[model samples]
Target: MKTLKQLLADKPKTLAVAAPDDSVFQALCVMAEYNVGALLVLQDGKLVGIFSERDYARKQIRNQRSSKETPVRDLMSARVAYVGIDATLEECMSLMTEKRFRHLPVLDDQGQVLGILSIGDLVKETISAQQFLIGELERYITS
Candidate 1:
């Protein structure tokens, strides 16, 4: 099984983050700039929450809240479900499926944010692994 650490190592080492007190508009701008669907909400380098497009659409826009006026902390998901670097892709997929959320912040032993994972990332990895295994099996069968 591939661990999150391996997946993260293969990805670009960039973390899109926002301060909890930052405006929702600011968080959205950062997300757009990074070309990501979500941003980790950090306070003093610690994971405090997460802000995503879903949060913006559900918590802010639906409620007629102004993104420019509202702080990210106000709409961000505070009860963040995170995973350690050693967590397997299957574990992440299970958790995400059960929770009905897409993003999960990866943490280190000290609870420092290492990176974030999305459902798309896990699915792609899983598909690649399966393809490789199938290729190997075919080669073995033909040998």
Candidate 2:
């Protein structure tokens, strides 16, 4: 029943971003610097799309497109899956699984981007919750 807000609070507050018109190479460099697999494509401070390592491999590398010439808008995934702060972890996980996405941008009610969530983040939270539940059950049974 944990919410996306709770999960985000546990993570380091950093969101790597790139301009939509930025070169794919520039975006990739930012990703490398941040040690993140994806970068949010922002245009005029709005969330426009997402560029990930997968996109680079599929759109640029596979097509042999020059990274410096390719724009993030052309290579980024435009159909982004967004998760609200109020959304449950289960909801986020289900959406990600159904969509086959490794990253989800966290949004607020006002459609403002807050943070990004990765499949790894969801998995870690699920495991922690399961452990807490198991511990509670064991204590209850022993008592």
Candidate 3:
């Protein structure tokens, strides 16, 4: 099983972040610029919560709140689901599915943010691994 460390290594090193005091519009601009669905909410370089499209739609749009006036802390999901760098792909998939989360923040032992993992990333990696395994098995049988 591939670990999150390896998976993260394969992805871009940039981590999208937004300040807790930032307006929801500002966070959404970051998300749009990065083409990401979420941003890790940080305060003084510490993870506090996550702001996603879902959060914006559910908390802001539905409530008729102004994105420019609403702070991310007001709409961000405070109880975030997180994973460690050493965690396996299967573990991440399981957690994401169980929690109905699209993204998970990857953290270190010191509780420092390393990267973020999306469900799409997990599924793509899993499919690629499966393809490699199947190709190997087919070659072995042919030999």
Candidate 4:
């Protein structure tokens, strides 16, 4: 399986972030614009939390909180579980599955934010890898 570093390198380098004090609505707009499901809550260029559509549905809407008035920090998942650049795809998948989370922020050796990965990203990579391996096996058999 590919490491987190490899996966990130293959992906686009853009990262969508939101300020802690930004309104939830503002964060939602950024998420929509980026076509992403979550945004890292950054404060002083550091990862503070993560806000996702799940948070909006379970925390904001369920609690009847106004997204326009509430800050992203209020709804973001504060205790984030992140992985290092060298972490394997299987490790990430296990952690995410155990935690029941859809997203994980990737960090470098110096704890700098590299990027974020979603469950969808992992699944797509796994499927791609399987397809490639299958094609290789078929070619070997034909040869």
Candidate 5:
């Protein structure tokens, strides 16, 4: 039952963001340079939407839209799935699976973003938790 806070503390915070008015290319470049799958669309210091690689492929490439001239608002996922700092790992997993989204923006109670999590991050945490549980059970049996 680890919380998002613990995960964020264990992993340093890194935010990738772009203004709502920014071009899709700009956000895409930021994501690529950061080696991340998503970008937070910010406007007036508020989280407006999320632009993911999947959005680029589906909305831009598949649709034959021009990434160079397209706005992220047109391609970004507006109703993104998110988690709060106090949310349990289970909630995060459920939201991601239900939404079919690979990344989720973690926000504070005030809607201020804390950090982002990827599917890989969740998987790694799950593996770590399983390992710890196994070790604890092994020690209990040995004792």
Candidate 6:
């Protein structure tokens, strides 16, 4: 089982934030620019919530909350499920699968934000692991 630490070491790029009260449009723009599906919502360097495209449709547009007037803090999913950097990649996969979320922020023990992981990240890792396993199996058979 690969650990979150290993995953982060493998892919050092992370999407992070320190404030959500700034502008919802900014968040959407950043996500679009990065081609990411979610953004970590933070306040005072602490993880507060998560703003995802899923939340956009369900909490805002469907609810008629004006994106231009609303803030990310107002639309974010405050009850975000988080994981530690030392956590297993499998754990992240399980949590996201059960909750149906595409992104998760990795935090330190003090609850400080470290990095964010997405479903795409998990899928990439899973595929890599599978490929390695397959190669090992092939080598074993050849031997």
TM-score winner: 3
lDDT of 5 by residue, 8-86 (tens): 7776566889777788888989998898888988888779999988888888865555777788899898887788888
> Relative to the true structure, how large is the alpha-carbon lDDT of every model?
0.91, 0.88, 0.91, 0.91, 0.85, 0.81
Worst 10 residues of 5 by lDDT: 61-70
Cα shift from native, residue 105, model 1 (Å): 0.9
State the lDDT at 21 in candidate 1. Answer: 91
**Regions more than 4 Å wrong, model 3:** none
- Which residue window of length 10 is worst by lDDT in model 3? 57-66
What are the per-residue Cα lDDT tens digits for candidate 6 across 7-126? 777764665452678577788888888777888887877888888888887777655556767888888999989898888878888999999888888889999877888889888888
Listed in order, each prediction's TM-score against the native is 0.95, 0.93, 0.95, 0.93, 0.91, 0.89
Which candidate model has the greater TM-score, 4 or 5?
4
Instruction: Answer with 3 or 6, whichever has the higher TM-score.
Output: 3
RMSD of each: 1.2, 1.4, 1.1, 1.4, 1.6, 1.8
Summarize candidate 2's per-residue lDDT along 23-95 as a digit string, tens digits. 9989999999999999999887789899999998888856557888888988899989897788888888899
| Pairs with steric clashes in candidate 3 | none
> Candidate 1 — worst ten consecutive residues by lDDT sum?
58-67
- Which pairs of residues collide in model 2? none
Per residue, candidate 1 scores C-alpha lDDT tens digits across 19-90 of 999999999999999999999999998999999999988888565668888999999999999998888888
Poorest lDDT segment (10 consecutive residues) of candidate 6: 10-19
